[model samples]
Every structure is written in structure tokens, then in C-alpha cells.
Target: MRTPHVERGATPVNVAGTGGHARRSTVTTHERIDVLLSLPGRSPEVTIDDTDVSERKHPHDEEKGAAKLQQEQSFEESSEETTYVEFEEGDPSNPANFSYARKWAITLAVSFFSLIAASSSAAYALGFPSMTRDLNATQFEATLGLSMWALALALVPLWSTSFSEEFGRQPVYIVSGVGSVLMHLMVALAQNIQTVIIGRFLGGAFGSTAAAMVGGTIADIWAPSERGLPMSVFAIMIMAGPGLGCVASGWIEQNPHLHWRWIQWIHVIFYGIFLVTFPLVMRETRPGVLLKRTAKKLRKKTGNMHYRARVEDQIPSLATLMYISCTRAIYLLLTEPVVAAFSVWAGFAWGILFVLVESIGPAFRSVHNFSTGEVGSVFASMIAGCIVGEFIQIYQEKLYAKYYPTKGPEARLFSACLAAVLFPAGMFIYAWCTFPSVPWIGMAMGIFVIMTSLFNIYVAVFTYLADCYGVFASSALAGQSLSRNLMGAIFPLFSEQMFSKLTYHWGNTLFACIATLMIPIPFALYWKGPAIRARSKFASQVIHK
Candidate 1:
């Protein structure tokens, strides 16, 4: 069998004899036909003898032959020509190859989005008293609004990640941003507890897109070697947002005229600004999606149906993509011990953080006789700790840069080692120093240590997972996020009870003991991570470079 070769977007000029006559067919590139009936070019005319047709063994034999011929030809061509959509190592168009300034700009924008969204999750906490009084609900019922928001944050990311993977990131950001703004408006306008709970849940559900996608965006633009600083900044934003929100909402709730509703209104004002600016700053960064779009444009311009991105060939159908997106995180969570361990560790730390968010106000009020504003101001310690963590991360980055080449991704765990000890130490201090005799600054110092340690652990886990999972890092992170946020949602519901039952001293001691037990995880991973990764099917497949 001879193969026909034609230039892209050109009409077919040469024709092979189909029935012994020099048959000519003008085949246009734009024509769509069945693989059996059509060749690369436009129409082709074949001259068959009437007697030869009459003498055929079967009338459909020719059609079967044509289909077989087309299949073989397609197989041979595709086998030789198969290519994927990927950046040529130094391609400037690739997000990873973007200028340092542009990359940081994008990073900061994404971090800002993440910060605001995360802030919204805890912003309502400051207004809990006012909200309960206004809605004629108990404190526990009012707290559900916050917990429901977190539940949505955990659950909605499962679908947001799937959508972001299928469509480009920009679309998800835009749609979710708009929806987030509207949900804030809904909450601000709510007349009763039901409306407030629904609004908070939906707001968090929509707002979660930023939280879910920002890490992936960081991964998209930064190479592993240079990712430390940006990742640190990203982690700081995640930790600081809620603290900052508490600080702001504390003042808002304290104002006699502007109480709980203004918290939602305030968010609307800020989030609305982000919604307007996000489109202008953020572009489509995903390589596969960009390539697919480019391929579509090229095919349209060149009129070459065969012109396609490599990703197009490999991309599963929407159903398959959705299935994978939905289940892949759960599968990784269940099967990958490294992911599961880090997830649980991170989730526990995150849960404690949320518990503090709820308990801190009451703790300050009971221990220090502080007002709402002063209680809100106490969150500054967490914010200060986040800033301190950022500075420490600079040192961590230097250490990573020094060791990463020789140690692989495990070099990123240096801070986690220190954080492990500091976490429990901070908890111990906070637990023991809760007496009215101890100055508030003493407890603030404890929070400072704990928040700093939390930031370090958070960054390490995120960076390590990204390093281990590589291309599938988003899914791995999603699983971690699910666990972390689920804990965040659940821990706060019982925080008041835990503190009440055990008292601040015993309450935090229990948490400190748990933290102490988990300290060995980071140490174990820092030492054994490479060996463990070497043995794992998924980790072994990930290309570090």
C-alpha cells in the first residue's frame, strides 16, 4: 500500500490509479468525510469498470477495503507524527519561563486573592455575639454559620479544581469571584439566621476557588529551584488572611452603628475590587490549555484538520476528565501514605488554628477582661508571627537552595523540623500562661510562636507535596486542602466546649500533646522521604527537573 502525503492546507493534486485509469480528484483540506471515504485532500474521482463492479464478490467489499486502508494509513501516520503540547525547554511563552518581575506580579495577585478569601472565612467570628443577638439565635447556632462556610470551603474545592483543570484558570477565577461578591451581598442583606448560614456557605463555596487554584498557579509559573520564596509568601498570605480579617472585623463589630452586617459589606467592597482587577492581571497560565487554544486558532487559520495540540490527543473526554478529577484526590489520599500522613498532620494544625480563631476572643475576654476591639487586636500577634515566618523563610530558602541539588525535594523540610518542636512549645506556653496573673503579652508570645510554626509547617508540606507529586501536585494539594478544611470546619464547632470542659490550661495541653506526638512525622520525612519516594510508584514517576 502506498501512502499519500499532502502539504497542510493544500489541495490534493496527484492521484493514484484506483481502477487502472489515471484518475484525478481535487480534494480540499476543509472537507470533512468519514475516515474510510476521505483522504488528506479534497475530492478524488475514481474510474471503475462497470463490468468489474458487477464481477465483485460482494457489493460492500470495496467499502470495507477502503475503511481498512484508511485505518492502516492513519495508524502509520499517527505513530510517526504523534507529539504532545509542551514547552520547548527555553520557550519564552511558557509560564515557567516568564520574567521574574511578571511572575512575582502574578504570584502576589493570586496571593492577594487567596488572602481575602481566607479572611472571609473567619471574618464573621468577630461578629458572633452581635449576629446571635440580632438573629435571636444561640451562640452555638451562630457559630454554625462559620462552620458551614468552612464546610463549603472544603467541599466546593473538589469541583472547582475539576473545572479549573478542564477549563483554564481564568474562567474559574472570574466566575467564582463574581459569585463570591454576590454571596457577600446576600449575607449582608440577610434578615434571619437561615439566610445568613446559606449566604455564608455559598460565599465560602465560591470564594474557595482562589484558595484551591492559587497553589497550582504558583506551581505553574515558578520552577522548583526558585519556588521557595513565592511559596513562602503564598503560605504567609494563607495564614495571615484570617488573622487580618479578625482584626478588621473586630473593629467593625465593636462600632455601635456598624456591626455584624457591615462585616459582610466590608468584604463586598474589597472583593469587588479584586473581581474587577483579576481579569486584567491574570492570564491563562496552564500550558496544556494554552496549547489547546493555540491549536484551535492555528487549525482555523491554516485550514488543517490534523493540526492539533499534543494534549488534545491525550486529553480524556469531559466525563473521563471529571471522573479523574473527582476521584484522583481521594485515591491519592487513601493510597499514598506520605500524602495521608502530611494531610493529617497539616489538617490537625489547621484545625487547631481555626479553634484558636474561635477561642481566642473568649480566652482574651475571660482572662484579660478585654473588650471586642481589644480581643480582635490580639490577632495581630498571629499576623506578626506570620511576618516573622516570612523572614525565617528567607533563611529556609537559602538552605533549600544550598541543599536541594544534592538532597532532592526533601531539602525543603528544614523549617518543618524546627517548626515541629516550636509548635508544641508554643502550645505548652499558651496552655500554662492562660492565668489572669500572666500578662496578655505572655500569651501573645505563645500565639506568635504557634503561628510562626504553623506557617513553616504549612509551607513545608505544600512545597514537599508539590515536589513529590510534580504534575499531579494540584490533586495532591486538593486532597490535603480537603482534609485541612474539613478539620477547620469541625474543630471550631467543638472548640468552645473543649475549652470550657478542660479549661484553657488542660484544653491547650491536650492539643499540645497531640502536636508533640506528630513532631516525629516531619523528622521522619526529612530523613526517610527520599527512600520512601524512591519506593513509591507515583513519586518515582514524578520528574524532579
Candidate 2:
């Protein structure tokens, strides 16, 4: 398919390059932007946009019109002669052609890695009180530890997303795993709060790989039609991580001997395990990276200098691609309505996730007289909800398979459509259930329902963006991650205050009302998404393909 004219009325400039020399390529800036935005393996047709062909025909005007026409034909013929490298039919190296068991294994490995990284987010929270006492830090300073992890998780992905795009998922994950472990060790051994803060920031920065790269990994292995189940597991881990982390870490905090340092030590231990396990299980799944590797092997074997993958010429240099990736995510956040809406939805949902981390300690303690361990145990409900969400996710997959051809990307929204109502419903349950008269399990049930809904929203935002954007999906999802994680970080900083000042009832009621307002996002997209996609600058070209 002809790549659309990327933006109207601009003179073509040389594409951005990896380094100094790459600026000399014949590819235009618009075409390069498309490449930067796309997923790794999606080699867009390298044909130039059908712009004016006559502009270069008479460069010297060596002869009259007949000679100039001949020159134009020659230029056109040369421009269209790009060759691409692709897998042979049933190529074993192609991740998509991998056996079902192999695909699920990779999916599980990636998800489990993500689960541990995500668990670290709230795992620190359970130990926050002990950290503050040990470091002689204020409550606000302790809160920074959580915010810092989230801040890095949000921003580092901007860089790692592009890095993974070039280097492939496993390399990024391995490095990230190592970096994360070291950071946890740093935190565990730190003598001061500042060191702890720095350690948390760097830890989340390293751990952020799982947040961004796993989507690409899933995309690499599973085609859009089959992406639902794996995406569900990924979403489950993300939603379940905080719950699972707190489930154990709270008890660690309750232990007289183990406390905060041990919490961090436990993190280091888990990350150490993941580093050893992940590289073995998850192969290099990025098709572009793999194909480029294959091209290198062929060139070396055949002694042919001309052999190259589609991306070698088409993509910008590593630094330039990272810059493009970060900026494009911001650009999409600003320019794409679908992205912005989903981002707001996902961000608010994530904010709620962390708010629970912050508020549960106070709410459970004040209202129910629960111990730190008991408050932490409350996250078990989050796990239960995720289990339910997975079942719902399976149903969503079935519905998707049944109706994807007719419904298009909208089919992905069934879970979201259901979640929209469940969100405020769960909030209402938790909010009004705040009374001492109500059993604590009522609040626990609220958490369960909210998490169940969060799972659906999380999965839908991820898979739908990927489904709609094709190669551009990573950028699309990254834009949402920026908004989602920033909001997630910021909300908890205030959730405790809001819940206290407004009281649990009004505070959560405020959130519920906001949730009610946002309920229309998925539904509107579900009903009008195709037409909206048809009009989008980026998403339009992807879905039907």
C-alpha cells in the first residue's frame, strides 16, 4: 500500500539518521517519522508518497521535453526498486510462526517479569513506614519513594521503547533486569533517605522496560487476531502486581526483624531470579531486529555488500529514533483523540490503583482497626479481581474472534464497555461501604470489583491501541503510558489528603463521579471508532490491513 502523504504541503527533507552520515539518505522526513512510529517488524512499503514526479526531471534540463520525460521515467523506476527481506513460509525464526506452546511460554515469561517489576511499585509502600523510621524521613519523603518509582516507570519507557524497537525486547529486558536488581540493592543498603529515593528512581527506570517493551513483545509473537489471551495475561500481571506485592510485603513490614531493608532485599532477590530466567525463555522476538540480524548473516556469508533489511535504510539512527519515539508519544497524546481519551481513562484507572496503595493503609486502619499486615493482605482482593478479569478476558477473546471482521477494533472494547459501568459501581461500593457498621469484607469486595474492572480497562487500552495503530501501536501505547503513569504517580501523593479531608465517603465519591463522567469514552469509541479511525492521521491506515 502507498504510504499516505504524511502531512500536506511540505518540501521533502532528508530523513533523520542514527548518526551523522544517515542524514544523506533519499528518504523524506515524513516517511521516516512513519517508520519511527511503527512497531519493529512492520516494514512499511518503502515507496515514496505519490507526490509531484516532475520536480526532479529537469535538474540539468540537458535536453528538451522528450529527454526530460525519459529522465523522469528513469528516476521513478529507480525509486520503486526497493527489495525487502522476509521470513520464508513457516520460518521457525519468525515468532509468529512459533508453536502455540512456545508462544505461551514466552508470553508467561514476559508477564511474570512484568509482574515482579510491577509488584515493586506497591511493595515499597507496605514498607514505607519502616523506611521512614529507619531513615528518619518525613511521611511526604516516604511518599516520594512511591512517586519516584512511578515517575521513572513513566519516563524511562519513553527511552526504552525506542531502544527496544532497535535492539529487540530480550536485550532491553536483560539490561533492565540487571539495572533493576542493582537499584534494589542500592536501596536495601542505603544509609539515608536521599540514597533510598535515588535508588527507587533508578529502580523504576530500569524496571520500566517491562511496562513498555512487553506490548511490543506480545505484538511480535501474536498477530492481532490472536493477541487477546496473551494481552490479558500481561494486563493481569500489571493489575495484580501491586496486590501481590503488598500481599507479601505487608507481612514483611509486620515482622519485627525483616522490615523495609528486607523488603528491598526481597525485591533484589526476585529481580535476580528474573534476570537469570528471562533471557533463557524469551527469544529475540522483534521481527525487524531478527530480520536485520538475518540480513547481516547473509551479507557475511555471501560477501554481498548490498544485502540489507528494509529498516536499515528506512529507520533513523538509534539516538534519533529515541528522540522521535519520545516526542511522537507526546505528539500523539496531544494530537490523537483516541489516544488521549484512552490515556485519560487508563491514567485515572492507574491513579486509582496507586491511591488504593496509599489510602488502604489509612482506611483499613482507621475504620477497621486492621494491622499493617492486615492492610497489606487487603491486596489479595486485587488478585482475586484479576483472576476474574482473566476469565472475562477469555470471554472477550471469544467475542473478538466472533465479531472482529464486522466490528473491527471495536470488538476489543466489550470488556471496556462492561468496565465503564463497573468502575463507578465499584467506587460506590467502596465509598458507601466506609461505615464501621459495614463489614470490612464489603470494602474488600469493592477492591475486588474495582480491580476486576481495572483489568479490563488496562487490557482494552493496550490491545485496542495496538490493534488500531499497527506498527505505530507502541508509540500510541507509550503516549498513553506517559499520561497513565504520571497521573498514577501524582494521584497517590494527594489521595491520602483527599480521602482524609473529604473523608473516605466524599473523597471516593469524588473519584466515582469522575469515573462516571469518563464512562462514555469506550462506548463512544466502540460505536464510532471505525469512522474515527478512518479520519485519524496515524491509526487510519492500520486496522483493515
Candidate 3:
């Protein structure tokens, strides 16, 4: 018998003749067919409508040729139920099938959403002095705007992650992205500092959605092995936004045409654009959501009422989803040791970054007598560092592929270890070089080192978590964000006092010492990570699944 080639998109149907010869439809999943009919000539065309999911049989002999098809169908259904439930091959709704241009469009839109939210917090730092005078607020009170933004960034992702899981990612992205834009406008129009803080808080609350879901969206499209380059790009955008905001805010504050309020205006305009573009380009990439939609469409077309794609196919009720949004994040944070360790390390780095941002301007102005714009230029050093870190990441990606082809998630830690050492090296350089006589270039070099390390470590950690946790990557990243953002929010509250009491030298030195102490963590994880993961209940379940 000649074997037939299966064509694309055609569901296989088996045609059985009276002589036991059977022809299979090119696209059908059925293995064989039995026929008792004596119908002569060429095989008749039989169309199976959507209603008949089970194999059809003649009334006289219903028992023949039925068992095999039923068994195959049951096995297929069981597989679909157990799997994460991705779209069928060539499904247009799947982000992986999106046109190249569309994928980039979605990526850029999401990046901008991240940019506006992250920039708002750091941009406000530049205008704190003006805000203090205009709003009749103390420096501390004006600082609350930044702190509030950070606090919201920390808190909101916990809830937003759950919503994204239930309602689908596109809805969360649009609603939150637009909500942030509206709050930015309110901040721009605020009558007092109190109003501005409230607006910023609300804005940050929504803005945090981009931070949490963007990676998950990317993951939905790109397989784990192919994700590193895009992950690097997104990581750069995430870190660069804050520093870029500082630079932009410096120029905005110095210009006679704009003031503190314009900072909020800029955020509003930026995010407003993302809000508009997101719905058009950003596709839902969540595996569960995509499968649910596919199943729905299939059910409608086929009229098969018994079709359920998976046990979790039911759309999560609003109340259940909300509860998940509120509770699971805290559960992950408290229970996951991997989360706890990374969160502490990331939080420390973030605290140091914000502290540097808050104090570096004063240090430069007092020591080098640079104008605000000139001081803002100092952030350029960090941009340079970010670029260098990207190169290092590229090289490390190659190294991992070649040397440790199957080294598991810990292989990603090589770059992270380098980052840990680089972090303190930068801190030490900057800590001791804050004197008036030192050239401004020295300070810039120190900052360059600090930022390069930060970016490298960030990408390494991000990739490692995504690789190790697999499906739980979102929650794990959210756990880290909560701790890191909290530190970013709170560290600046006492930064001024630390600078005053200990002097810039000792103050930054303390940070350097702490960073240096963490240098061993990645190395230890590199050696013992598999065992650590084995002991984790969540990690075990995720790995097995």
C-alpha cells in the first residue's frame, strides 16, 4: 500500500470500503478505518460535521472500527488537558506566528510603557527642590512623590500578575497603561504636592503592569533558548529608563519653558502613545488564554458540547481572580527561597542605584561646580556601562552554549558572578573618588562601572529565573520586583542623613561593602543550585510539569 502525504490544515478522515481498503484524510489524526458497505466505484466523499467528535459507525455493526479511533481521541484529549495548551499550528492569534513587524511593534510599545513609568519616578527626583519651594513642602515631603511611586511599583505587580493570568494580558496592558497616562495628567495638573503624590502613586500602580507582564509576553512568543537577545534588550530598557529620566528632567527643570509640572506632562504624552498603540499591535500571548480562545472557536465551529481543552478551561471568575491577584504574590515571596535570595540582592543593588541618583548630583555640583545639565550628563557614563554590559552578555551567551550545553540554569550565573564583583568595584571607585579635587571624569568612570555591573547582573538573573522556574517565572520576577522597588522607595528617605552623617565617602563605602559581601551568592548557587531546586516544592512541581 502506498503511504499518503498529509497536507497542512486538513483534518484526517478515514474512508473504509467493502474490501477493507481504507484511505485516510491527509489531516486526520485517525490511524485506520473498517468498512462493511458494498458501495461500488470510487470512494464516496463523507463530510463529518462538528457534532460528531467520536467515530461514526454503521447501525448494523456499531462495535466494529470504533475502539481504535476512540482510544486515539481519548489519548489526544488527555494530552491537551495536561499540557499548557498552546494554539494549533499556524494559528494567527499566537504571538509566535505574528509578523516580524508586528512582534517588534508590540515590543516597542511595551518598552515605552515601561519607560514612562520608570522615568516618572526618577524624573521627579530632579525637580524635588523646585517642588519643595512651589508646593510648600519640605525636602522630605517632596521626596514622597518618588517614594510613593516606588511603593506603588512594588505593590501593584502582585495584583496585576493575577489579573494577567485570568483576564488575559492584553486587557491588563491596555487598562493599566491608559490608567497610568491619566494619572500622569492628573499629576501635571495637581494643585498641591499631596495631589501630585497621590497621582504618582496611582500612576505607578498601573505602570507596574508593564514591568511584570512584558517578560511573560515575550516568553509566550520566544522559546527559552531563543529569548536571551530580546531579554537583553528589554533589560536595558528597564534599567535605562530611570537614568534617562534623570537626564531629561535635568534639562526640563533648567529650561525656562518648562518646570516640574512638565515632567508629568512628558510622562503623560509618552505613555499616552503606548496606550494607543498597544491594543492594535500587542497580541495575547498567555498560553492558557490563547488555548482557551482556540478551544472556544473550535467548539463553536464543531458544535461539540463535550469539548473542554483542559481542567482549567473555565474562565476564572472575577472574584477568584482578584483573590489570586492579592494573595499568591505574597505566598510566593514568603515561600520561595530562590525568590528571597535574589530579592535581597536585587533590593540592595536598587537601593544603591537610587541613592547614587539622589546624591550624585549634589556631589558633582559641590565638588566640580557643574551646572545641573552638566551633572545630568554624568548619567551618560551609565549608558556606556549598559552598552559594555550588553557586549559581555553576548559573549557569555556564546560561552554558555559552547562550554556548558547542558549545565542547567546555573550556567547563567557565570555572568552574574562577574556582575557581583563588578558592582562593588564600581562602588569602591566611586566611594573614594568624591573629593573636590578629583576630576569629574573619575566620577564618571566610577558610575560607568556601577551601571555596567548592574545591567549585567540584572540580565543574568532575569534569564536564570526564567530558565529555572519555567512557568513560575512571572511570579518569581514579581517577588523580586516587590523587594527591589521597596528598597528603591525607602533608601532615599534616609539618603540625605547618611550622606551628612558619614560623608559621601563613608556612606557609599557602606554600600560597597554590602555589595562585596554578596559576591559569593551566585558562585554558591552555581555549585548547589540543582539541590536547592530539588528541595523546593514549587520548583519541583514546575519542573515535573
TM-score for each predicted model, relative to the true structure: 0.83, 0.83, 0.81
lDDT of all the models against the reference?
0.79, 0.81, 0.73
Query: What residue runs in model 3 are displaced by over 4 Å at the alpha carbon?
Result: 1-86, 294-318, 321-328, 541-545
Give a tens-digit lDDT track for model 2, residues 1-545: 11112233322222122110111223332243343443244344445433344444765543454465676667754443322345555667777777888899899998888898999988998887788898999877888889998899889888777776588777888888888889999999999999988999999898888777776788788976677668777888887898999999989999999998998899888887887777677788877787677666655765644445656756778898888889989999999999999999999998998888878887888999999999988999999999999999889988988998899888989999999999999999999989899999999999999999999898888778978998888789889999999998899888777776899989998999999999999999998998888999999878473
Q: What is the C-alpha RMSD of each candidate to the true structure, in Å?
A: 8.7, 8.8, 9.9
Best by lDDT: 2
Greater TM-score among 1 and 3 belongs to: 1
Clashing pairs in 3: 10-27, 11-27, 11-28, 12-27, 12-28
Clashing pairs in model 2, backbone N/Cα/C closer than 3 A: 17-317, 18-317, 38-471, 39-471
What does the lDDT read for residue 175 in candidate 1? 89
lDDT of 1 by residue, 292-329 (tens): 77556644764645544544544665666667766888
Candidate order (lDDT): 2, 1, 3
